[model samples]
Target: MNSSDGGTATPAASGAPRSGPRASYPAEQSAGSRRRWFVGLSVLVVVVGVALAWLGYTKFATPDVAGEATAYEILNPSTVSVQLTVTRKDPSEPAVCVVRGRSKDGDETGRREILIPGGTQTQIGMRTEVTTSKPPVIGEVFGCTMNVPPYLTQPAT
Candidate 1:
């Protein structure tokens, strides 16, 4: 059958099967599929950005060292020594370090308190001798503490 405008009737009116891609599906359904794909892509991009930010924070969020242990010497049965390289990020920040020694049995044999004056240099190397109760087989640094200890003092003029 033909319509009043002289065009062939659609499958619904003529009762014949439709042909071609657009005729197979409705326009609203195709638009809905496109919207779903766009939403899925947007979610994937946000998840990837969050994951990258977390990785960056975990890799770079720790404090840096104030001082580092450079070397040590087990001089004699009664004495041990350690060499430390101190760093002062702030010129007024004093440095106090605890140097320790260990015996052959892996027991602590000695510990010494060291003080380095601040406002002089960014990095300084110092050596201090430690008294030991027994012969120390090795010497190591426990860690360095910022600022001066209570017992340190300067002589009065």
Candidate 2:
């Protein structure tokens, strides 16, 4: 027997017992390393999947309510007329919007809270006149809030 080729005998020539590819490390150690790598990869994949799901839920799965001022006109020195539209996902929910008037000097001249009655309409269009103490240069809708009516909260008398 020639002691060459790092003593790893070829089965075809030396009749040694071998079945698969040669490994530099022990079979059990290599198998264990592969298993650990597989488990780590699986965990990473799961974590990433969960993170993506949470992000999607927060960004796309929630409802949004918004309002916009469509048009405004200065009726008089202390009065301004405004037209606004409120949009919501659930139209049955009542909304309150704050309207404001600003003077030429950028001071808030008037502010009013307008009530929007709830109905089956998703988009509500409203027109109102805002009164101010000084001459108003512009009128705008600040924002809107969706809430249950106070009449619904009181107990029956």
Candidate 3:
């Protein structure tokens, strides 16, 4: 309402776009653009999902090298002797395995890496001692790989 005219002002008279419902929305996308955007996002999601699934499978699938802690003995207050069994898909490929000792509380107390030389046999057993920070009640085989560190490859001094 204008004080001079003393009457309600219509939107046309007020020189403004209509406010509230039935107003024209800005930046509206055509049907084609909306469909293209949807397809692009779907393809991106599928690609990412496939990549992630492949990564996870590679991690948990049967590995070329495997190690198991078959038995353990408490040799001393801070030492444990672990019997490790190593198996390789290709016995000709050398592998390295990591062993660990865990306390009764399930805390890792010690860790050691040992080398397994390539041989004709697919599986072999070895006993190694792990020095722990505290007494250990259990032993575990962390993992094994054919990628032997250079330090391990070096001959003893």
Candidate 4:
């Protein structure tokens, strides 16, 4: 029935389609809204990635002191001598290096810290011996750092 008769007309009787929603509210999302959401998420991810890269570079990329275990010798059953070559970016800054001994089964048997005194030379080679609880097959350099403990530093004269 038409509105003039004080009765509502069914959609089937009217020209409106019975299968889908009306044009006012669509069933699927609009293209513009979806594109905007995707662009916002992409920009957030790029910003987070750049922030992480900057943090990693500043913390680890360029260390003041770096060292390498050039050679090693199994001195005896419980001892391993390691030859370390250290390079200091600022030769005037003192640094400390940690060396370790590893067993055949890849277990860390022993560790020692050697001090690199500040000097005019940028590079220094030193040989140190590490005593191990178990027989060691090789010696390796763990890392070098400028954060030296109080005991490792010499007192002012």
Q: Which model scores highest in lDDT?
A: 4
Q: Candidate 1, clashing residue pairs?
A: none
lDDT of each: 0.74, 0.81, 0.87, 0.89
Give stretches of model 3 more than 4 Å off.
Answer: 1-23, 27-30, 76-78, 103-110
Any residue pairs clashing in model 4, and if so which?
none
Specify the poorest-scoring 10-residue window by lDDT in model 1. 1-10
> Whose TM-score is higher: candidate 2's or candidate 3's?
3
Worst 10 residues of 4 by lDDT: 16-25
Please give the TM-score that candidate 3 achieves against the real structure: 0.65
- Error of model 4, residue 15, in angstroms: 20
Q: What tens-digit string does per-residue lDDT give for candidate 3 at 10-108?
A: 754576654443343464789999999999999999999999999999988888988998998999889999998998999988899999999988899
* Candidate 1 lDDT, 1-157, residue by residue in tens: 3443334567535766544554555646578888999999999999999999999998776422255668878788988877888776664666777888889999988998777776657778888888889898877778776746677656535
In model 3, state the lDDT of residue 62: 87
TM-score of each: 0.55, 0.58, 0.65, 0.70
* TM-score, prediction 4: 0.70
**Model 4 bad stretches (over 4 Å):** 1-20, 23-46, 154-157
Best-to-worst ranking by TM-score: 4, 3, 2, 1
Clashes of each: 0, 0, 0, 0
Q: Which stretches in model 2 have alpha-carbon errors above 4 Å?
A: 1-63, 148-157
